[model samples]
Every structure is written in C-alpha cells, then in structure tokens.
Target: MPTIPSPRHAARRSLFQSGIGLRLALAALLSALVWLTIAWALAT
Candidate 1:
C-alpha cells in the first residue's frame, strides 16, 4: 500500500515552491506605492 501525504504537508510544499516569488512581488509593489505616496505628500 502507498502512503498518502497529508493535506498540510502538500500545501506546505507548494507554498515553499511558489510563495517566494509572490512575496517578493508583493514587497516590491508595496514599496513602490509607499515611495510614491511619500513623494506626492511632499510635493503637495
């Protein structure tokens, strides 16, 4: 009989494989938005 992986284990593996790219993209987008907001505040 083959052993099956738990749902938690499979989810964790998929997150490790694909989550970093998503996290990095989100960080970059957030930083850009913050920078633009600061610049706009200073200008006005």
Candidate 2:
C-alpha cells in the first residue's frame, strides 16, 4: 500500500508550484508588521 498525501500538503505544493508562495509569504509578513506596529503604538 502507498501512503497518501494530506490536503494541506497538496494545497501548499500548488501554491509554490504556481509561484504564489513568495507573494503569500510577503503578504503575511507585511500583515504581521502592521499588527506589530499597532501593538507597539498601544504599548507606548
């Protein structure tokens, strides 16, 4: 019997295969920085 791949793995593979992984990563990093800025502003 062969092992089966998970859906999450398939989705991630497709993301990279289509060259969207880098864009997605950059978007996520930018979003995180925005949140960090907000938190810092509230803390200060």
- lDDT of model 2 at residue 11? 82
Candidate 2 regions with alpha-carbon error over 4 angstroms: 1-18
Best-performing candidate as measured by TM-score = 1
Give per-residue CA lDDT, model 1, range 1-44, as digits (tens): 23456777888889997888899999999999999999999999
lDDT (10s digit) by residue, model 2, range 1-44: 23356777788799787787678888999999999999999999
Best candidate, lDDT? 1
In order of appearance, the predictions have TM-scores of 0.61, 0.58
TM-score of structure candidate 2: 0.58
Error of 1 at 21 (Å): 0.7
Report lDDT per candidate: 0.89, 0.85
